[model samples]
Target: MTSININKEKFGQLIHKEKPVLVDFWAPWCGYCRRIGTAYEKISEEYSDILIAGKVNIDEEPQ
Candidate 1:
């Protein structure tokens, strides 16, 4: 239901899971990223049972 905040360390494992996954790659300074982030969160809650939703802050973990 809740979105997971991930970094380079957790990305591979999370993406490899059996369930469907949605990952939002964004940076703090981007307005468009923030706008979509709200929508992403809502969708995550709505489809929590069917998929895994996560986010990665590109600025923090460029790798």
Candidate 2:
């Protein structure tokens, strides 16, 4: 699996490139993050052309 760090501007480029992108806006303490993890993984595997399936830790990013 490949990973890259990106912000909103890059995310816009991703959309224009026809890359199927999934952004998981999550924090470590969020219970929903755990629940959605499996679903996100399944999506990544299901789509072959997705360029980005990114996990954004809001806890770490500058606001």
Question: Which candidate ranks first by TM-score, i.e. highest?
Answer: 1
Clash pairs, model 1 backbone: none
In angstroms, the error of model 1 at 32 is: 0.3
Candidate 2's C-alpha runs over 4 A off are 1-16
Query: 23, model 1: CA deviation in Å?
Result: 0.6
RMSD of 1: 1.0
lDDT winner among the candidates? 1
RMSD for each of the candidates: 1.0, 2.9
lDDT of the candidates, in the order given = 0.88, 0.69
lDDT of 2 by residue, 1-63 (tens): 534445766666777766767777888898998798788777766664655777667787745
Candidate 1, residues 7-58, lDDT tens digits: the string is 8768888878888888898999999998888899999999999999999898
Worst 10 residues of 2 by lDDT: 1-10
Residue pairs in clash, model 2: none
Give the C-alpha miss distance for residue 5 in model 2, angstroms. Answer: 5.9
